[model samples]
Target chain A: MSELEIAGCSKYYKKNGEPMCALAETDLHVKNGRFVSIIGPSGCGKSTLFNIIAGLIRPSGGHVLLDGKDITQESGHVGYMLQKDLLLPWRSILDNVIIGLEIRGVSKKQARERALPMLKNYGLGGFEYDHPDALSGGMRQRAGLIRTLLYDKDVILLDEPFGALDAQTRMQMQNWLLDIWKDFKKTVLFVTHDIDEAIYLSDEIHVFTHRPGRIKATIEVDLPRPRSEKTLMNDRFLTLKKELLLMLREEQVSSN
Target chain B: MSDQLKDNEPFIEDPSVRTTKLRRRAFVGQVLVGVIILFLWEFLTRLGWLDSYYWSSPSTIVRTGWKAITQGTLLQDLAYTSGSTILGFVSGTAAGYILGLSFWWSELYSRIFEPYMIAFNAIPKLALAPVLVIMFGIGFDSKVVLAFLMTIIVAAIAACSGVQSVDRDLEKMLVSLGAKRRHVFMKVVVPTTIPWIVSILKINISLALAGTIVGEFISSRQGIGRMILYAGQVLNIDLVWVGVVALSLLSIVMYLGTVWLEHVLMKGRAPKS
Candidate 1:
């Protein structure tokens, strides 16, 4: 059984007396411990789809099940990261990491003990008590990832986690993320508008069409694990990027 | 002492240290200006340039304050005023925070109470102090009630806006993190409004003191306000100045104490970035 299953999910919104659709009969299933990427243009409801899977928003018409059980009503089970690295500035790096644990009713002492290993493993050992403002943007994002991963959840939803980083820092983060994922083996659903990122990180790519977003295509990335920016220079990565770009262009024309 | 070999050297300052030093220097400059103004007043009075009958010299005021202190009347009056001010401040702040939280929770409560609150606030509370004294008598209760009336209005307004002004993204983030309505209130809403509430409390401290002093002047047989009234009636300008200076000092001390308390409580708690 899959770790997450979204069957026939749809969402809609009304704007200025005009009916606008965000998702339409979208069905997706993620096997346990798989890295899946959802790629599309802006306003494609990719984030909306992730919200549905994470149970942040209820589907207008469908069911979201986890491991053969309906979890549509349950929240806090999935770890989510947004575009902005929303680290509480008042909280130290260690405190930020342990916030999810604290929220889930893990005792503070126990949470700190559990969090220490993760912090040390991620190279944030000596900076446990240092607040978020003291850290650089790249360091902040790394701490955010540690925050989500330390929650000990089997599924994680990353919404443009590295979208705020510079090009050099973003490349560094991609390598770091792949290493973390390789070790954790958790089910991952990453949303991004960057085609290069989609091709680089994903085991499989789901291309989304324009508004009232529907799946355009599902392309499996046949690349090896622990890929780098050098992989982007290779023919396979370029070909996958080309295919995704073409699909997005056709969707853009139709939506226009 | 011999082991501590001291070399005279200029201090190497951090950037933030230099900034702090600059701020302290500015504060000292303001204090020097205040001292200069006081010295001018004293000089004018001593030289007979200003009328000594109405405006007493600073030394005369200080002497009057010393006489009041020796007789223990100053301490007695201070106790009466401080007691009323403290009681009224605590009651008003508690009422304000509760009402503000209620307003945040229920739109219906806000609609019904908000307009009435505004109407009541607009009526000069000082004008009502006489009527309040008439109703509650010349004891501490009337003074406290007057002070409470003065403070709660502003505190409630500040708290209501603070609660309303919380960042929407923070609320959404908390909600999406599986926090229920009550949890969101406890975790996100409360922390965000604390700095605002503290600032409001600082503002209300002076208002609360004013309310107490006004009540004292109109009805109380004792207190700094009554002392001022008697001194003015007898044309003892020095005693009047003493009472004014005492009140000013009390207000400054209270404000600074509250600020220090805020620092202690809000340490590592504020979300400023």
Candidate 2:
């Protein structure tokens, strides 16, 4: 029911008064309740495609369909999270977490009632009334993830959501994300530059080439469920990582 | 540990307590300086080193102020100054804040008015006091208008900068949550800019008071400024000092009141760190 499709999407920019292609025509599909990741180099149009998919930018040519309905240039069909967690500084954690519901016209009391359990369950129980600055980096990210979930949309777009976290915290957050993803049964489209992170968290990873970016390969990660640090040591995990590294290396070397 | 403690025994004050002690000493030193200056001025006048006619002694000034307070309509004058200041401050700030934030609604409107706002900010508003007095008349309306003029541009500029510096990510997050334009302004734009607006409040109050006093000075029959102007014209030096002291005290009280207002607005809203 929550499938997302990006059909023939492309983006162009004018540089020095000359039209330049940033993202070539690309198509992407995420079936119901699947975890998909987009990985590419720094200058590639991954973010351009990401913004187009989020409907934050209008593509030069393409259509984004959600659940078989055309939603191109129409935002609010999915929840979006960025690298920096944008919790309002003045709002208490409880209030910040419930902002999605608040914006969607839910009564404050009812939003609070619904958010209370999630906050308590997600290691944020005692900090319900504290401001955003009171929380550590990882805790704030958790709060942001909860906010995204509570938006009540089945499709969630996480653009380097854990990119800013330290290594240890990033691993823990990935496990936490997987647990939540399983429990909620939501479709997630994750964008990141880290191959290890993409392999660990995603069911499928789409690799993009440099500049005028388009998908170069779509690899399905076939690993055991309830994965742990041991999974990273597995031969399959190592093999997939090598394959992704080689693909990305080609782009990086070519651009250089 | 014992050796370390002994090494540090020359200065055992805790950090926070040391700061408090230093602040108390600063306050005491300020009061001592004021008292010493006032005593010297009064003593020099009485000893004829300074002429009593030209340089009024503190005691004479106090006596003149007491006489004015009990017998003259000094309270009414105080009330008049206070009224115009308050009316101008509230009206100007509210109107300017709303106008500045409204710039978010349309790019065209913001672009057109931004240069005009900068131009207005560059002009010395007090120079327009006489003209404002002429248009609004030499009554309460004139004083109120001058005060309003003094505060409006500053508040508008502050609010405009606040709106401009609003985090794009916050706005994007809100939009993604299905928030309308007005909702983003109200929830994200306004709250994020509150600190900026409040940071200007202290400056605005002082400017508003200056505007009211200048209006009073120009052509008013009432207010402390009027009393001071009239006393100076008539060479009533002691009365002039009385008016000066009264105005100083009045402004200090109003400044404290503004501080309290800022506290109320920013309570629990400041960043925890």
Clashes of each: 0, 0
B-chain TM-score, candidate 1: 0.89
Docking class of 1: acceptable
**Candidate 1 residue A164 C-alpha distance from true site, Å:** 1.6
RMSD of 1: 3.6
The fraction of correct interface contacts reproduced by each prediction comes to 0.25, 0.62
TM-score of chain A of 2: 0.98
Which ten residues in a row are the worst by lDDT in model 1 chain A? A71-80
lDDT by residue for model 1 over A39-126, one digit each (tens)?
8888889888877876778788888888878877467777778877777766778887887777777898999999999888876878
Candidate 1 residue runs with Cα over 4 Å from true position: B1-31, B107-112, B269-272
- Model 1: per-residue Cα lDDT at residue B166: 75
Compute the lDDT of residue B4 as modeled in candidate 1: 46
- Which regions of candidate 2 fall more than 4 Å away from where they truly are? B1-27, B48-51, B271-273
Per-residue C-alpha lDDT of model 2 across residues A59-106, encoded as one tens digit per residue: 999899998899988778898999899999988889998998988889
The lDDT leader among the candidates is 2
